[model samples]
Target: MDERIRHLGFGHPWLRGGPGAGDGGETSRLPWLSSLLLAVLVLVGTGFAAEGQPDREPLDVFARLLLLAGPALLLLRYRRPVVCVLGVALSVLVYLGAGYPYGPVLITVAVAVFAAIVSGHRRAAWWAIGLLWAGHLLVVHLLYRHLPPSGDAAASWWPEVGVAAWVAAVLVGSELVGMRRERWAHDRRERAAAETRRADEERLRIARELHDVLAHSLSVIHVQAGVGLALLDSDPEQARTALTTVKAASKEALGEVRQVLDTLRTSGAAPRAPAPGLDRLPELAEQAAGAGLAVELAYDGERVPLAPGADLAAFRIVQEALTNVVRHSGSRTARVRVGYGTDRLTLRIDDTGPATGDEAGGSGNGLAGMRERAAALGGAIEAGPRPDGGFRVRASLPLTPKETP
Candidate 1:
């Protein structure tokens, strides 16, 4: 109901309101009848004058008033359609009642009847419509006190009912067509909005993933580059090994970025090799210890073999968590838990970071990337600063495979 009112411009006729209301389309179709009918009437008046038919003697003044007023009512048909119609009916009846046989007013009278039919008020239109046409027949005959020409029932009655009924049918049909047009327009807008939302979500996910990949790899390279620079004056061979680690991590970051881009370009996601999972936690623990951070790896629940994507997601979650700890935590202590339950794979990372600022939980996209990876695999995540003055990253991926196990 609200939509309908909006479409009709608050139902104010003074607003020049209708469907397609805001634009000039409603007024685009010119009212050709006003000009055309008057021009034809001018020529008609000239022709009748040439014929030199004698004008009628003066009748009651009321009859002349009606003759003047009847067709003028037609001009206001749409704005006050019923009033215009009723006025025409009464005025024309009075004109005939006072004995004018025929007049030029029938042009506007015919138009009024037809306008009423074309609008949706068939009942009002039909009644006034009946009086106008029926009055024409009765007036012509009774004034002469004789039957109309070719006065058979079929010939006389058929044109009136058939023409009016056809006009009413057209009005109803047009309203139905307008309804379909409105429905189509609404559906088109909704579909376009949905597409726009999907595009936005995809861009955000891409941004988060890009940040995680670059941040993780760059942090590792920064460590190795520092070691190489330190060992350059001490042990040349160890420095060369540090450079190799930096090179390998850099190459890995480039490959990850390219794979994400490839998936976007063709919408054909390439298979990613299985990455670090719970089984590789020992290596992560050793790396943290080497970096002078005490990291404990623990597990509960059933040990489950994760899919390749889930494994990589779990690895990144832990990686980002520990990286954040090293960068922010004053204490060199962190704990990671990989819990493989019956229906889900969970990775929980906790660090004794200062958790001082709003960014204590890693305000960057590392946490966001973890969540996105889990969500893409039909999963969930919750990460923020712990009340115990630390940060935690917990992610869960559903065990169900994308296709089949």
Candidate 2:
């Protein structure tokens, strides 16, 4: 219900005072305080104006009541701006018809008009102010002699021109204020949306980083563990080597996991170590060998410095592709090719053979993570079975610097 009212630009319908009482995103207690002040100003100002205009009817109980009526109606301007403006305008018209002295009394109607327009009720404000102006003209020009203070003559057209100008000024000023408020609201919404988008992108990046780190390390540990258990009884020495490889892989995995966690704990802090890049390819090949998979590394172009983002993406793509080969392929050999270009870097990993092993089935998140990394760096990844037999993954990453999302 509250959201519905806010969306309608009326604020809370039941709130008549305090913050958020007014409509169209007003959240101050100014309206409440201003209402009280306006009532007093109108009463006192009109009494003084009456002293100067001896030809007008003297101040009476009904005249004072009419002056206060407009300000009283202003209390509901925020929650019901259109209704408040109409009531205030009517009070102003009746006060004029009664031949009461005009002074700060018009101030009440101006305030109502401003509120109505700012609250997104522009048409209602126009009608109320327009009717008030027409009614004032009618009383002063045609009905003056019949209405109040005896011997009153009809008002001149020149004064009516000034009244029309005042009305136009009020309408223009109200429109300006409303437009400014809407612009401010639009900027705030845009900033909030940008913040939300950045947060989502950060979460996705972290998830992909964690997946690449754990998947490759765990695959190596799994193969070494299996070897250790199989040879434990007959060949203790070989089993010890396998155990050593498992321990090393697990320790490296934990280190990478801790590095990723450090980023979450320290906002905007420099990383304890630089992110892994293509420089780590040899280390990856060693790890794959420990998992009973031999990886052959080849280069196709002259080595050139890569942007940090592109380098990191290239390394991860190769890592994920090799990890997939280790888990899913029957062949024990995989080949990795790195091609450096003028504006982009290409990486291709191929394994020769058919599928095998219990680890052949996977959640498929590895390929997805690789694709996301390449895409983030304005690149693309293609993974499918090579027409010959084994599977292949080819990735092309731009060399351009990637802005932080």
The clash numbers for all candidates, in the given order, read 0, 1
Worst 10 residues of 2 by lDDT: 12-21
Model 1, 65-123: lDDT tens digits are 55556556655556555556667777766654444434465555555555544443344
Which residue runs of candidate 1 sit more than 4 Å off their true CA positions? 1-168, 234-237, 269-297, 305-313, 330-333, 352-363, 368-390
Strongest candidate by lDDT: 2
Candidate with maximal TM-score: 2
Off by over 4 Å in 2: 1-30, 141-153, 357-362, 401-405
Global lDDT scores for all candidate models:
0.62, 0.85
Per-residue lDDT tens digits for candidate 2, residues 38-140, read: 9989988888888899888788899888988998888888766766888899998998888888799999999999987777677678888888988988898
TM-score of each: 0.56, 0.86
* Candidate 1 colliding pairs, count: 0
